[model samples]
Target: MLNSSFDTASPSSMSNMSGRWDFGGEKEPLMHRIHAYPAKFPAFITQKAVAHARERGVEVKRIADVFCGCGTTALEAKRLNTDFWGCDINPVATLIARVKRNDYQKTRLEHYLADILRSYARRHRLHYSPYLKDDRLNYWFDEGTILELSRVKAAIDTVPEGKYHDFFLCAFSNILKPTSKWLTKSIKPQVDPDKKPVDVLPAFEGQVALMIKALNEVSEQPGKPTKKAASIIVTGNILEMDFAEPMVDLIVTSPPYVTSYEYADLHQLSSLWLGYTDDYRKLRTGTMGSLYHDSDFNRDIKNLNATGYGIVFQLYDVDRRKAKATARYFADLLKTVRQCVKLLNPGGMLLFVIGNTEYKGVKIDNADYLLSCLVDEGFCEIESTKRAISSKILTPYRDARGKFTTDTTSRKVYAEEFVVTGRC
Candidate 1:
């Protein structure tokens, strides 16, 4: 129930942000906070989007989130009794998204915990040969910490493959950063020489305790929506997904910021430990705005709309590398919009919770770019609105770690974001 703090944007505001997108559920569910996710929008946005669709006479029987970062929309869809289909390139995201949606049996959770504890105590098979060879793991984790996490992983595997196994694996995956040298509360990946790694068993148990509380809260909490529909979360690049037929009644999602965060780097600990990839850098492939992709900028620049080209053209003079990435991002969004149209039933709605970012004094107006995309794709009834991200520019600056600060020397993050919607 995270608050949107919705209020009507002033009539003269250039963005013309409608106040309707501002109203939503006021508190966040405990289930949604089980894992840390970069750029996950407030869960209530899903509720608000659903309500918006219903108000427009769209009966949302099925919903989809093309870029379902950490499954915020998926869980809310289940609570609202609408079937959900979601996909993310990062497996770490899909794992948490899948786990967050299930209402597991308390007894089974306890049973698995007790078994894992006993197996962990025995401490056999602690030394995994791969640990010695993996440079990335060695850089982050000490030898002792690796052995302890290995035992926890092995014990978690003792649970047969299913939601229960995934649940434990998700727990194990979260503990990797705390038990390693990775800096705390920092979005950037760096080793904190001062960080004394927390003991594995205590951290794992604490996480489990927190998860149990979340489960209890979901089951006993009054006003918690009943689960009436199932959620399907997939791990794959959305750009390559083939939609053979229109399947969803509505699409509600927030697209990733162009080159703002490298999801693969952010989730390296989980991806590596969970065996998602041998080299975490490889996960960058096909990721939106990733500089690593092979993009022919000269040829692809034609796909951009005026808003898109203007932003890229501005950046090209100062930074050629970033300009290429930005152009590719624009092209991808254009294609993504067309693909989204393919997934929607005729007259279905596409609602996006997106924001704009600035780089080197140049504005990257993502909202406007997307609005143009919706138009190019021929989505009718297009609408756009603005919402506040924080106290209006009270702490407009972000420190090196991506935390908000009032200091003018730091990077500026706009206090406002846009909510753009259209009907296909």
Candidate 2:
């Protein structure tokens, strides 16, 4: 399923002096477009790392992505036959990952698709009150559009519990940002006035059909060997997870960018529509990120108000220029990393996919700083890779002024991300 054999890097290519492997190109074979997020790495990057592990005579049974946004890592893992475990603070994202990774019967998926469509057609005309309504709905969509989405979601909820249920729930989540008035200003949702709102029923139907096609294409491929284990994806905070020591093989993830996209606020429509929360703005403050972080943390807005610093330093002292936020965030990150390190088999690898962020012109070399934490905590920096985000095939979102209106920088290039590997 992976095209790694044709593109594997030679030993000479692995040198740090080469700077970073250019994982550039428009032809990302993995499922990057399954759904759109403001910032997500191509699945091929993960493919490269996994291939590197195999080349080292290492047998990888399990792969875990803590910030499994939109399931990029999990999807690639399934394609490569690696036992996959994923976790995310967003419930909707975890739902998407589960639906994509599950080995559902192909015939069953087709049957389920047809059955749900027919069921939806029968119920489409029924009148019903909106699931969760607020002023935002009035500001975002007309009455007809809301009614259409409500009926479709209600019908989807009624699908018999099985593979179909998971698929439809994810489909519903995917449809939220696109069909509503949430503008393509960026990954985050902003109510758009100039653009016409899309009709809900047709949009829902199109998504279902698109999903079936994607599922069919992916399931047709033969898979590689895996750990024969099912990865668990939790929809709650990782801080609350009860994991025993040494519980994972490898840790790979890209946490939320500093002072960049406001994830919860961006997906407020989904949160509101799916019964996660009725108060939309509350998402901005409740999450431990961005300027919205609690005052108790003393987040530095001039530093792009990044949260989660102190929790990280507890694992290792950070040598960054500024240390404004409480050590709570860094401490929590170390706790999670320590849990991941404990989960690994001896000599297991940790591949961290992170970015150095800039907020109000302050550099937050988070990736490098994070690697330092790992190194200080009994991990060895084996190798690292850096790549420009500009080289990848992007969906190309921008405003008339040729600026990224939604991103915090409002510049052509926003932040730089990296893939740093450490061995324990």
Best prediction by TM-score: 1
lDDT for model 1: 0.83
Q: Which one is best on lDDT?
A: 1
Model 2, 102-131: lDDT tens digits are 766767766776777777788766665664
Candidate lDDT scores, in order, read 0.83, 0.62
Q: Write model 1 residue lDDT over 1-424, tens digit each, in one string.
A: 1012312332113255556666564778888888888888988888989988999899899999999878899988877878999999999999998988776999999998999999988877566656657889999998888888888887898999999998898888888888999998667788999999999999999998888898787677566655568688899999999989999999999888877778899999999988999999999998987767788998779888787898999989877887899899999888889889999999899998888877667777888888778877888777778887743446666665666676665556777789888898
Cα RMSDs, all models: 4.3, 7.1
- Which residue runs does candidate 1 get wrong by more than 4 Å? 1-14, 17-19, 124-129, 221-227, 391-411
* Residue 288 in model 1: lDDT: 87
